[model samples]
Target: MHPDVAVDILKKAETSLVSYRDTGFADAQTSAKEICEEMNVEAALKQKRLRTTKRQFSYEAPDEPITDALKKMEFSFFNVVVDMAIESLRERTGMMSDVAKKFSVLISFSSELEKQAKDLCNTLTSGDHSDLNYDELIVEMQSFPKQWPKQNMTKLDLVFLEEKGLKEIYPNMWVALRIAVTTPVSVVSAERSFSKL
Candidate 1:
């Protein structure tokens, strides 16, 4: 299942709890206490089943402990969320450091791209710019969250840098940003392709 779907399910479950708290049940005449008790039991059973299914599908090795598998699964889910946030250029609220670390991981995944990014950083730091200064571009990128009020810049923004006239202003930085946004980390499509093989 997609992580988005899982998140949706969890959100719905939370909303249901809120609704249950606000209005005990649809029928006011009925015994709300008994009904809630029964619903709680049912919810517990469903949660158990869901956990069992997740454990079964997340099997890593023959001798691997379930706790270890669960830990790995949690990390993978967190990584996916981080990747989605970074690609979409979401504000990420207070996760700037974490996002930057994940961005580093994503860039490091490709040695060629990592080399290019390093080269661009070097060129900028070496003061060899013909138009835009490297320090200025780095400052702009770092302060993007504050500069853009809505913080709605997406991967498409990086793709069409000329629309915002950013290419001419931050050429090297724009290229590196484009590469970061365009890199594909998810293997869902690749897995699907291999399924038919």
Candidate 2:
């Protein structure tokens, strides 16, 4: 793998975590340059070990060029780092993250996110006995940004403060958030528990 590709993967892995989002995660140029420094340390160690050894060089085979050895080491490091980055991205974006990305409408909404919200609604309503109404949900979702009142509305309790709750106000969103987003995990697991393995 190319060092640039490895650095890009590392950047993706680093930014995938919410904690590292604001840290810049060490730029690609710096990370690529780090390989040479690591190679220097590795070379010094090899030289020190050779000095203490009693083995002599063989005439049958030629010694590999230092540049070739460095290139090999650099490529090896790139492959390993890229693999590690892929694993980290997979591990971090778990089932819950998938659900969150799908139902992010609960947290915030914008013109850009409308398509995602519509798709989420469509996917939710595609199944049998789905509680969401795609057409209504799409219309409501389009207008939600205007009525959002955007007061860090992560919790649903505040919206449910009234006697009738959000259902009476934004019926589609209420169903989308409450029924689809909240029930998918437990509902699927519960249904599967009774099925044959």
**Model 2 C-alpha lDDT per residue in residues 1-197, reported as the tens digit of each score:** 22223344545655664343322233443664687687764322232222334557877765544454334544566445655755665553454455656666655665556677666766676456566666676677666546554664553442452445546657767766554323323224456465221
| Residues 50-145 of candidate 1: C-alpha lDDT, one tens digit per residue | 233344555564454335433444345544554454443322222332333333421233335444344446533435554334455455454343
Q: Best-fitting candidate, measured by lDDT?
A: 2
Clashing pairs in 1: none
The TM-scores of all predictions, comma-separated, are 0.28, 0.41
Off by over 4 Å in 1: 1-101, 104-149, 158-160, 188-197
Q: Which stretches of candidate 2 lie over 4 Å from their true place?
A: 1-92, 126-129, 143-151, 155-158, 161-166, 180-197
State each model's C-alpha RMSD to the native. Answer: 15.3, 11.8
